[model samples]
Target: MAQVDRQQWDVVVVGAGGAGLRAAIEARERGARTAVVCKSLFGKAHTVMAEGGIAASMGNVNGHDNWQVHFRDTMRGGKFLGQWRMAELHAREAPDRVWELETWGALFDRTPDGRISQRNFGGHEYPRLAHVGDRTGLELIRTLQQKATALQQEDFAAYGDHEARLKVFQECTVTRVLKDGGRVAGAFCYERESGRFFVLEAPAVVLATGGIGKSFKTTSNSWEYTGDGHALALLAGAPLLNMEFVQFHPTGMVWPPSVKGILVTESVRGDGGVLRNSDGRRFMFDYVPDVFKDKYAQTEDEADRWYEDPDGNRRPPELLPRDEVARAINAEVKAGRGSPHGGVFLDVSTRMSPERVKRRLPSMYHQFKELADVDITAEPMEVGPTCHYVMGGVAVDSETAAAEGVPGLFAAGEVAGGMHGSNRLGGNSLSDLLVFGRRAGLHAAALAAAPGPRPRVSPEQVDAAAAEALAPFHAREGAENPYTLHQELQSAMNDLVGIIRREDEMAEALRRLASLRERAARAGVEGHRQFNPGWHLALDLRNMLLVSECVARAALERTESRGGHTREDCPAMERAWRPVNLLCRPVEPPPADPAADRIRLERVRTEPIRPDLLALFEKEELVKYLAEEELPE
Candidate 1:
C-alpha cells in the first residue's frame, strides 16, 4: 500500500460528539478495545452547540407526562412519518438515560423537591426537557467525557496504560469506511494538523457524525458538519433514508451580518419568549394549523396564562413544533412584516424580569450581549430560520442501530434516520444521542466479540482513499477555488431546496448540484496539507457535494408537504405518502465523469405502526395522519 500507519481496535467510532463518546463508553464497558476520532477538539463537537435541553419523559415537572404522551408527541411532530418503533424506544428509555447522567456526575437544574427539573419545549404535551440553564448539551458532553475518562482510569490501574482500552483521536477526520467485500473492516483517516494518513482496522465501526447543515448558505451548524458521515455511509453501499427532510430552526440570529445564522436557542421560546411582527403583533396566533389548533391557546390571554397554569390552559402557539414556527416566520417576512434585518422579532423582555432571564438563559444572554451588542433582557432580537438539523441519515435497524445491507456498520444521533422522521421535536436530540448511542455500541461490541475470523482491511481500498484525498493538491489548469465553489453550493441549496420547496426549484437545484460536482473534482487548494484550512475544505467539498445531491434528488422525488419538508405545489400533507420513505443509495459503479448523476433514489414502505402503540392516540387524531387502510376498525 502507501506505508500508512495502522492501529487495530475492536470498535472504531468516527465521531467524538455526545453519541460517539457514549458509544465508546458502552463498547469499552462491554470489554472491547475502542477508539473515537473527531474533526474537532475532544469536547468541541457540534453537540456543545445544542442549547436547549435533553427530552425525556421523566414526569418530574408534570406527573401526567409519561412515555405514551411523549411518543404521541414525537410521531405528531414528525407528521407521523417517523419510524414508530424508534419513537417508542426513545420515549420509553430516555428518562433512564437522563437519570444515568446524574449518576455519572452531571449537575442538572433541579426543582423545589430536588428532582431533575424538566422544562417545556415545542411539540411535547408536557414539561419534559431536563436542562442546565440553556447549556444542557455542554453538560451532557462533559458527563460522557468524564465517564470515558473514569473507564480509562480503571484501565490504567489494571493494564498500566490509560489508553489500553479506550482512546480518543481529536483533530482527525475519517474520509472512508474501509471494507472487505461487503462487511466493514475499519476506517481510513487523516490527522488534520500533520496531514498524515492512517488506518484504524477494526471489525466494527459506529458512525455518529452529526448532520449536513453546512450545505446551506445560512446555517446553524459549525464548519466541521460537512456531511462526512452521510457521504461515507453512501459510498460504502449503505442507503440514506429520506435526505429530503431538513430542519431550519426558527430562531437564528439575523442581524449584524457577521453573526448571521448563529443559533438562538429554542430555550428562548421554551422559557417565555414570544414571536412578534413589525406591527407588534404576536403573529403566532394567526398561524396555527388545523392539526395543532386544539392543543394551542387561541388568544393572548389564554396563552399567557398557560405559563403559570399549564393544566388549565393550552400552550401558546409560540410553542408549536419547529417546522410550523419556521414557516410562520418565513410567511411574516414575505408579507413585509419583518424587522429591519429581515426577520421577525423574538422578545423575552416583556415576559420575564431581567434577573430571571439571565438565570434561565445564561448562555443566550451572553451570546446576544457580546455578539450583537444587544441585551436580550432589555429588547427583542431579530431572528429568522436557519438550516439546522437533517432528519434523513443512514438507514438502520430500529433495535440494534445496525445499518441495513452493511453487516458491521451502525449509526445513531443525527446521522441515523427514522428516529425523528420528517422533523425532530426540540430537546429529543440529546436524549437520542444517549439512548441509541448506547444501543449501537452494545451491538457493535457483541459483533466484534463473536467467535469468528475478523474482516481484513483491503490495501487497495486504502490506497484509493489516499489517492482521492491527495487529488485536490495536484490540480489541472483552470481549476476552481474550493471556497468559491462551496459558496455557490450553499447558495443553491438555501435558495432552492431549503425550508420550503417546489418541484421546479428542486429540479433546478439538482442541475446546479451536478455542475458543482464536476467543478468540485477540480477544486484546488494553494497551500501544503499541513495545517492548511484550504486543503481541508477542498477535501470536505467532495462530501458536501455528494450529500447535497442526495438532498436535492430526494427532495424533488417526494412530492408532498410534511413537517420539515414543505412542497409549495403540493402543499397539503398527503395521507397516502405517509407510509413511504425515500432512500438515496449510491449508484453502483459510480459514473466516471463527475458531472453525471451519482445517486439513485428509491421508494421503500415504512414498517407499520404497532397496534398497541397506535391505540395510544385517539382514533379521531389518527384519522388525520393515517390512510384509511392503516386506521383501526
Candidate 2:
C-alpha cells in the first residue's frame, strides 16, 4: 500500500484558476483554514489563457446599459434555458465583482474620461465588457493571485504560519471526493512530482474546477480541463444539469496544423472584425436566425454604421451569439466557400488601422504573427469552429452554490451549471468565476463552522482509494495503451457529437463510449510512477470517459436545436423541450465493479420563471425564441 499523508482543514478548494483563487481568498479571510489543490502549478491555470474581457453591466460606456438589460441579454443568449435566479444574481453582482477587482489593483484600460472602459461583445446590447487590451483574463488571474497571496500574508501575521494553514497544493491531482456518512469529508489526491498520496480532510469542499472542453479533439482548453470537478461531484452523488450543451466558438485558428484549434479571441470581432468568404463577400448576413433577424443588420453599410451608432443601426450579424456564428462558419466551409485552410476569413484591417489593431489586440496580433507567420494587422486570418466550453455541470443552488444532491459540497465557475443555460456569452466566464466563487466560499466557510463533529476517514477507505490509483501499473499484459484510448475518445466526440449532431450518429457514439469504457478499464501503464505521463493519463481517462458518457447520453436525449445543442433531425427549437433539462447520474454496479458502472440520464422539468423577470422582456421578444412555462394549478 502507498503511504498516505493526512491533514485537516476547514475548507478545501479544488482547482487554482480564477474561481478557486477567489474562493480561497474569501474563505481564508473569513478565518477558515483553507487549502487549494490543483493539477498544475499555481498561476498557470487556463484562466490566464482567457484574452477577450470580463462581462459586467457597469454602464461605463453606454449610460442606458444596466443590470436589467444585461440580465435580459444573458437569458436570450442562453436560449432562455438559464436558471432565472442564477442569471439574475450573476448580472446583479458582476459589476461589483469587477469594481472590487479594480480596487484590488487590477489595471484595466480607461476611457477618455478616466473611468474603466467597457467594450462590445456578441449578444450584449451595449458595450459591457471591462477589458485590459486583449489580455483581460491574464489581469483577472494576476489580480486574484495577488489578493490570495496578500490574504496568506495576513494569516501569517495573525497565526504565525500560513504554509500549514492556508496552503496551496500545486501540481497535485484530486481523484475522488471522500465522504463520511453522506457528507463531504475531504478529498483524496496525489502529487504529480512524487506520485505520493495525500488525504485532505475538510468539513467543506468547493469545486471550482473549470469546464470539460478538453474532452474534444479540437479545443481551446488546456490539458488540465478534463472535467475533474464535474466527474467528482457526479461520483460523489450529485446530478449534472444540462449536459448536452457544449459551445464551439466561431473563430479558432485553422491554419498551421500545430496551432489548429487555438483560440482566436472574440475581441477581434468585438473590435470591428468581419467574416468573409474566398469570393470577397461578407457571409454573416445570410446566416441570421429568425430569433434575431430583425435585430441584426442585413447589409455591410448598416453593420459598419452600427459599430459607431448602434442605437440608430441594427447590430451586425457577425456579432450573433456564439452558437449561431459557429454554425454559419461550418456551413460556409461545407459549401466550398472556405479559405485554402478549410475555414473562412476573419479580417480586421478593412475597418481598423494597423496601429489600433495592434494596440487593442496585442496578444492576438502576436499569436498570429508567431504561430501562423501571418500579420493580422495587414491581412485576414483563417478561422473555424473549435470546442470551447461546456454549459453543463454539477447542479447547485442558485443562492448558496451548494451541490444539490450532496451535502457539504459546493460548486462555482464552469464546474457548476445553470448560470449560462444552453450557451454562454464570451466574457461571462471571468465574471462568473468572481461572482459565484465568492458565494461558494462564503457558504462553505459557514457550513464548516457549523456545530457538527469533524468527519473521519477509515483505513479501509484510504487503502481502497490508493489501490485504485495503482491498478493501471499492474494490469494484465497486452492491456490497451492509455494514449491510444484518449485519442479514440477525442476523435469520437469531435466527429459524432460535435457542433452539428444527428440522432443516428449520437446513438452510435453511445455504443462506442460503452466499448471505450470497457477498454479504458483494462488500459495499463509502464514505468515508475514518478512523472509518468502515461500513468497520469491512465487515471484521467476514468474521469474523461464518464464525462463523455454524460455528454453523449444527454445529446441523444435532447431533440431540439437551441443554443449549443443542435439536432439535425429536430432542426428547430421545440417549445415542448424548453421547460426541461437533462441531468446525468451514476448507476453503481451491483457487484462493486468499477468497470461495470454505468451513467444514467433523465430529463427534469424546470420551474416557471419569476413574474418580475417575465416583465423585463417584451412579448414579441419571446414569441418564438422563448415563452414562460405555464404554471400548474
Candidate 3:
C-alpha cells in the first residue's frame, strides 16, 4: 500500500457550511484544536443556496412573536411529528444565535426602528425571518467565515501558527468514519484537487454534510449533497430517523429546461406574491386543507389585507406551509392548469412595483434574467415543486448533537435528524443550523477534552477505504458506466419515491435500487484519481445508493400521508403514525444475495411532549394532529 498523509486534531468537522463553520468556531473557542473538512472551496458549502432568511423570534416586526409562538409554529409545520425537544431548543436558542452573529460582525437589513429586519415565510405566525435581502445565506457565510479567520489570527498571535488552533481542509471528501472498538477514531479522506488520501485522527467527528437531494433528478441542491454524512453515520452503525420525509419546495425554476430545479426563494410569496393557475385564479385559496382553513384567508380581500394588518386578517393561502403549497402546485399541473413549462405561475410583478422587486430580491431577479431570459419585474415566473430538503438524517441526542449508538460522533445542520421532523418550515433550516451547530460543537469539544485515552485509528480500515476508492480504476471491459448508473438512480428515485409516493411504486423503486446496487459495484471510470471527477462520482455512488434505498424502504413502510411523505392510497394523515418514527439501520455484516435488503426499518415511539410545551397549543388545534392518548386527558 502507498504511504498516506496523517494529521491529528481534537475535533474533525466534516463540512465547512454554516453548521460546520459554527461548530469549528465553538470547538476552537473551547480550547480544542479543530480541523474542518469540506468538499468544495472554503465558504462555498451548500448553505449558500439558502436564500429566504433565518427564522428567529427576535420580534422586531411583530411584538406578539416569541419563542413559544415559534415553537408552536414549528410543531404545526412538521405536523407535530418533530422531536419536540429539538424544536423547543431551536426556538429558544435561535434568537441568541442570530444576535451572536451580529456581534461577530453580521450586518442584517434593519427595520425603521433600527432592529434587525424580519420577514414573513410559510408556516410562521409572524414576520420571524431575519434577513439581508434575498441573499441572507451568503451574508451568513461571509460573517462566519470572517469570524473563523479572526480566531485563526488570534491563534497566530498566541501560538505563532495560524492553524495551531483551527484549520480548514478545503476540497476534501471523507470516504469513511474510522472507528476503534465502538467509538469514533477519525475519518479517511481524499483531496479532490490532487486525489491524495489522508487520515485526520480525532476523538470527535462532526457530520454536517447537508442533504441527499442530488440523488433525485430535479433538485435545488448542488452536487455536494449526495447524503455523504447520512451514509457515513449508517455505515458506522447509527440509525437514520424518518428517512421517508423529503421536502419539495413549492417554487423552483420551471422553464428553459437548463435551470429547471434551481430554487425560487420563498421570499417572493412572503413579500405578497401569489400562486395563480392558467385561468388567473388564486388557486391556493381553493386548495387550503381543512387543517389550515381557519388560519389562511378564503377571500382575496382578506388575504390581501393581511400584508398591512396581519393582526386583523388571516394570512394568504399562498403563505401556507411548504408541503401544502407544493402539493397544490403539483395538483394544478396535473389538472392541466400548468404554465407552458408544466408549472404554475408565481406572480409578484402585479403585486409589487419593479423598484421594490429589484430592491428586495436582487438574486431572484438576476437568476431568472440570466438563466431563463425572463424579466421578473414585468412578468410572472414559471415555477413548480423541486426536491429541496430531507428531514430524515443521523439520529442524535436533542441536547448534545451526539449521534446515537456512536460514541465521540456528533451531527448537526441538515445532516442531523429530529430537529425539523417530517417537513421543515421555509426559514427554519438556517436557524436549525445555528442552534444545533453550536450545541454539537460545544459537546464535541467537551468530549474531546475528557480525561481518557484517544480512540485508535485502525490501519486495516484505512487500507479497506483506499482499496474501495481505487476499485473503479481496475474494472474489466463492459463494466457499468458510473454516469449512466447515476442517471438511472436519479430517474428511479424521482419517478417513484418523489413528493407523492405509493406502496407499489416504492416497492418497485426498491427492486430497481437492488439492481442498481449490483451494477454500481461494477461501476467504472476511465481516468486516474488526480483531479478525476469521474472517479469521485464513482465513489459517491455508494452513498447515493444507500440513502436512496433508505428513502424507498421507509416510504413504503409508512402507510399514511403526513408532511412530505404523501401517499395517494392513504391520503389522510393518521394520528397513529404521528408518534412512531421509522429508523433506518444498515443490515449487519454482508449478504451474499444481490437482491437482499441492505437497510432494516425499525419503528420507534417518540417521546411525549412536555406538559408546558403541550400547553402552548390550544386543545382544539392539538386534536387535529395528536392521537387520543397523546393529548392531555
Q: Give the per-residue lDDT of model 3 (tens digit) for 302-327.
A: 88788778564389989999999999
Question: On residues 91-155, what C-alpha lDDT tens digit does candidate 1 reach at each position?
Answer: 99999999999999999999999999998898898999999999999999999988998998899
Better of 2 and 3 by lDDT: 3
Model 2: weakest 10-residue lDDT segment is 624-633
lDDT string for model 2 (302-330, tens) is 88888888554388888899999999998
TM-score preference between candidates 2 and 3, better one: 3
Backbone collisions counted per model? 0, 0, 0
Q: What is the TM-score of each candidate against the true structure?
A: 0.99, 0.98, 0.99
